[model samples]
Target: MTDASSSLSSLIWADWPAPDHVKACVSTRIGGFSPAPYDSFNMGDHVGDSPANVVKNRARFLHLCRLKRVGQWLTQVHGTQVVEAKDDGKVREGDAVYSHEANLPCVVMTADCLPVLFTDEQGSVVAAAHAGWRGLASGVLEKTVATMGVAPSSVLAWMGPAIGRHQFEVGGEVRREFVEHHPATDQAFQPDYQSRGKYYADLYELARIRLGLIGVHQVFGGGFCTWKDERFYSFRREGTTGRMASMIWIKK
Candidate 1:
């Protein structure tokens, strides 16, 4: 039995460049009721954690955030599918979700994969995206930014913790997907010696490139590495693991 009230002290929330009207946060794996790999703050339901503990953990975390309804969804096999948060509880398969309506908290879960949050200058809209390599390459950020119905120039983004470049070993095919998207992706890939057909890839840089292409230059955050930081949940670091959430919303 974990204490939900006292557990709020352990999650990590990003302090991005967005204005006060937009409320955004990313949870770490420190505050919840589970044991071992899913010890605490594991918000993912399909990751093999006990369903009851996952439920308790999510309820406890949601309560701690003081939110009644949070929009979370079924993330499909890495691709860029952006949907509306109004589709919450419907189990839509998508990599991103956004809403112009107030009080609809959009969220994405992650371990080593990147969770990116977005909002505009007016703070009338907010979005969250699950950007694993394929999603990033397939334009997940671009898709999310387009859902805002605002000028892309007015958008701001915050890249949450993810697998760092040094630890993200990718095969030639993975690198091909990015380079095929943009030849400039070469800059974000480096040779990996541990295997003959692998390279170190930087997810943040790849996202920045895609975001910049869509005119989102006011981006912030993106310096943390889930695989390297003990405070975060890293699927790559630990084979069977927990997931943390990155969320964003407009206070209604």
Candidate 2:
């Protein structure tokens, strides 16, 4: 468990040039009420963490972030579906959530999968996407940018923590899926010398390639390895573990 005194300090704020009205943060695995394995700050209720503990942790998160509304958490299916975040209190089924509304946080929970936060230069819209290998390969980021209803050039993106390149080993099929979409993606995978048919995948590079293709050139905040950094959760490292959240919102 993490120290209560360090709870507020544990959040990793996005270091980007987003507009003044745009607020974003990614929670670390510190400061909460869960026990070992899910120990301390586990934001995902869908994981094995106690629902009550997840609730308390989320409450502490909102309190620390000074957010007025509950986050719009999706039942992420590793697909390319993008939905608008509303105050309807419905748990939508999608890999991404975008919102132009104030105080309505668009959030994505991730352990090792990439969590991407988006916002327009005008700060009128903000979004969060859960980009696992499946979703990333299938165009979740593209769908998110398209849903923002703004020119892709006007959007700024931030790649949150995830499994880093060296730590993310993948099978031949995973590499083939990406290379099949864009042959250039082949460069993002390097063969694992010791393990035949296995390769190390760079999710960050793949995300940058996707965002660049969609005209979002002002991307920032990559290089965090969830597997190596214990501050965040990593399903790849611990099969049964908690999840962290990356949240973005427009200020009221």
Candidate 3:
């Protein structure tokens, strides 16, 4: 059990050159109603956190963040599915979210996996995606930009905290899969010196290369290491852990 009150001041705000009406932020594991394992700040309701605690945490989150409406939360499955955001209180099943409506935030929750927030230069669109290695290899980011309904060149994406390169060791199969999809992914991976068939993959670099290939070159954020930094959650570091949330919306 820990202090129940928390503030958004410690949150990770997306630093980008997006239009004024566009707002984006990423949550860190800081303070909340949860106890122990889930600790104080856990945004993922599907992670065995108490429903009541989740409700209190999310409600307090909105109040503190001053969001007039609720964010669209999805049942992320590490897939490339992108869905238009809706705040109707129904849990949407997808790994990515997009929205054009004001105050309706597109949210994605993740632990270790990458969470990406997107918006257009004109602030007419916003989207978020949960990109793990599998999601990356399967084109979640590509589909996210496509679902935003904006030209890839106009999309400005910000990658939030994730498992960083140094700690994200992957098997050769993962490397080969990404390289097979795009040769540029090769540059994002470095062979593990101690392991014969493993590599330390740079998710940020991979994402940037993937986004660049689609004409979305102004990618930002992402030097964060969830496993190394105790401020964020990491499923790889802790088998039973909470998830941080990445969100974006157009302000009216």
Clashes within 3 Å, all models in order: 0, 0, 0
Decide which is better by lDDT, 1 or 3. Answer: 3
For all predicted structures, in order, the TM-scores are: 0.93, 0.97, 0.96
Clashing pairs in 1: none
Candidate 2 positional error at 3, Å: 2.5
- Candidate 2 residue 62 C-alpha distance from true site, Å: 0.8
- Residue pair clashes in candidate 3: none
Over the stretch 127-185, how does candidate 2's per-residue lDDT look in tens digits?
Answer: 99999999999999999999999999999999999999999999999999999878888
Give each model's whole-structure lDDT. Answer: 0.83, 0.91, 0.87
> Per lDDT, what order, best first?
2, 3, 1
Q: Which clashing pairs does model 2 show?
A: none
* Selected candidate, larger TM-score, 1 vs 3: 3
Q: Is candidate 2 or candidate 3 better by lDDT?
A: 2
Candidate 1, 93-195: lDDT as tens digits? 8888888877668878899888889998989888899999978888888888887789999998998999999999999999998898698888899988768
lDDT, residue 183, candidate 3: 95
* Number of the candidate with higher TM-score, 2 or 3: 2
